[model samples]
Target: MMMKKKSKLFVNCEEAVKICDKSQYNEAGLWDKIRLKLHLILCGGCKKYSSSNSKLTSLCSKAKLNALTHQQKEAMKKVIESESAK
Candidate 1:
């Protein structure tokens, strides 16, 4: 007798968001693909979530380039100290 493999459960939008965040859906695996398709079918919320997440990620990447480093902090501290000494 041959044993049958158990199939994975199909999840809703909220679950899909968690799965997507963990990159569990990035692979070309069968279950992951089916989860994505199911999510698209039943939930507009998940669709918006996916789009917004991508947009936020891109904005964060751009903001990172404008962030201050430790050296800049030290330079600002030195200027403040000099001014206070006067």
Candidate 2:
């Protein structure tokens, strides 16, 4: 027997994270918002996870306007290259 495919309208914690990243909570469509709210109500781990991700996203947005210095960029590039080589 073939398994049924689930609809995107019903999302889980990971999907909620992706949706939240793309749209504001209030602006997200009804299904997405409802799914997220339900998950948050039942799952403490997911709630904390979502909160931290939101905070991190806000921090990154603020940092982008006043970006890293050349020295910091170079350091980041070096780190990236080293990680890629490994």
Residue range 1-86, candidate 1, lDDT tens digits = 99966446667666688766655335445676668667767788887877787787778778886767999999999999999999
Candidate 1 clash figure, as a count: 0
In model 1, residue pairs whose N, Cα or C atoms come closer than 3 Å (at least 3 residues apart or on different chains), thus clashing, are none
Lowest summed lDDT window (length 10), candidate 1: 20-29
| lDDT for each residue of candidate 2 in 1-86, tens digit (9 for 90 to 100) | 99989875466767867666655434677677778777787778778877887898788778886779999999999999999999
Per-candidate local distance difference test: 0.72, 0.76
What lDDT is reached at residue 39 by model 1? Answer: 75
Q: State the TM-score for model 1.
A: 0.49
In the order shown, what is each candidate's alpha-carbon RMSD? 6.7, 6.7
How displaced is residue 46 in candidate 2, in Å?
2.0
Return the lDDT, model 1, position 42: 74
Model 1 lDDT, residue 3, Cα? 100
